[model samples]
Target: MPRVRALSGPKPRDAPEPSHPMPRHLRTLTALLRRAETVTLLAVLCVAGGLWAFAALAAEMLEGDLHVFDETLLMALRRAGDPARPIGGPHLEIVMRDITALGGITVLTLVTISAMVYLVLRRQRASALFLAVAVLGGQVLSRIAKAGFARPRPDLVPHGVDVTSASFPSGHSMMAAVTYLTLAVMLARQEPAWPIRAFFVVVAALLAISVGLSRVYLGVHWPSDVLAGWALGAAWALLVWLVARWMGRRGGIEPDRARPE
Candidate 1:
């Protein structure tokens, strides 16, 4: 057979065994990262931050207008949370305000995060860290903002509940938004499908909005206060989500389960 060229000269070193194909999980993650969905998330967060900065600046510029509008809302909810005048019994309004305050949420968030850490220790350390950072940062920001505004609570309306914080923005509302929203995101990351993931996102949003509204309705917060708190809280939530995405990229937390093709 004309010497067959020595059977192709040492069999081409067995074709290097096809490089030992990566595991399915690794392959999938690599493919997901190649799509760069995390980059898009960071872009969205940037936009949100920019928008929040603009809103805060605008509110500062229109401090007089905002104060007027807030007084208007305060007038409407006179019976709900005016700590100055006892209306329909501060009892009911106090209960409602407590329902939306940070104390109960603090306990609830701690328990939830503790359980998640125990259950998902290997895959959720970074998520847990981001959660802690967001919560602490939000609390600090709220304190600073409240002190800077140093706006007195409305004495024109009945004060239905006791509050120690300044009245420019609702601290309880802000903290509830940040804490619950962050926990919701962490929970969403563990789910397998996108729809359920989206559902949780909506639920978190609704919870935050509802808490903000409760503050306004109870007359403990001005409408502007709640609005500012919502904007700031939403911005913080987006920032935390950005950090989580970075963690996912660095293989700190597990990849988000709902990656696209």
Candidate 2:
């Protein structure tokens, strides 16, 4: 009876334990996103392949197809917008004309000059080099497609714009799209703010698209030609973006600048 010793200090409980597993809904959502990404990649590859095939077909029927399509679109645009007729405002006509000029040397020079300046400022020699390759690669692809197709420019429509290159897919359209899209990617990398980034990208894309459309409005290219240009140009742009992303991940290259938070 010196203090009665406790029979047992403690006893283990034998009851079910609470579970804290991840919610099924969240798990399902995660899996869905991953699956979506995979599907998107597959679709991109399919589009690229399809564009390449179409480019080949266009090449085969280049001169003939360009002539027919250009004529048809010319009539449609003339009835729709009538660049020459001009609805009323002098400003509108001037604006449209200016946009028409955008697909030519002006846009190319702008992008090249800007890229050069960016490289000089940021000291991103590798990125600059890759950018150059992407631009030239797009150009070369355009030329090869044109040469292979040997499509002539529109004669029926009385070309509103001058031409030199063979025209299955519009060269100006391709170049403008590639250049603008490339610049968009570069800026997107540097600017993290989604709204600002989206604004710039949309602006660039719109400018490119307008320039391409202006060609048709001007009675120079077929709608199909411009469309093909867009597809091919977009494919090349995505290819460049993938390259940049790869380089960044590997730490071999840094984008032009960091997005300011």
Candidate number achieving the greatest lDDT relative to the actual structure: 2
Candidate 1 lDDT, 66-170, residue by residue in tens: 667777776665544533543445575666676676434566467556846853665566566666667778788878888887777766665556677788767
**Model 2: per-residue Cα lDDT over 1-261, one tens digit each:** 489866986778798787788898888778866964785587579557847856664664544544555556667555345445423355555666678777777768677668757865877777777777778888888888778766667654556556778767888888888888877876576666768777867987898899888777666677777887887887778777767876876876675343423
Residue-level lDDT for 189 in candidate 1: 75
Number of clashes found in candidate 1: 8
Error of 1 at 15 (Å): 37
The parts of candidate 1 lying over 4 Å away from their true place are 1-54, 57-62, 79-95, 102-105, 108-123, 259-261
- Could you estimate the TM-score for every candidate? 0.71, 0.73
State residue 88's C-alpha deviation in candidate 2, in Å.
7.2
List, in order, the clash count of every candidate structure.
Answer: 8, 3
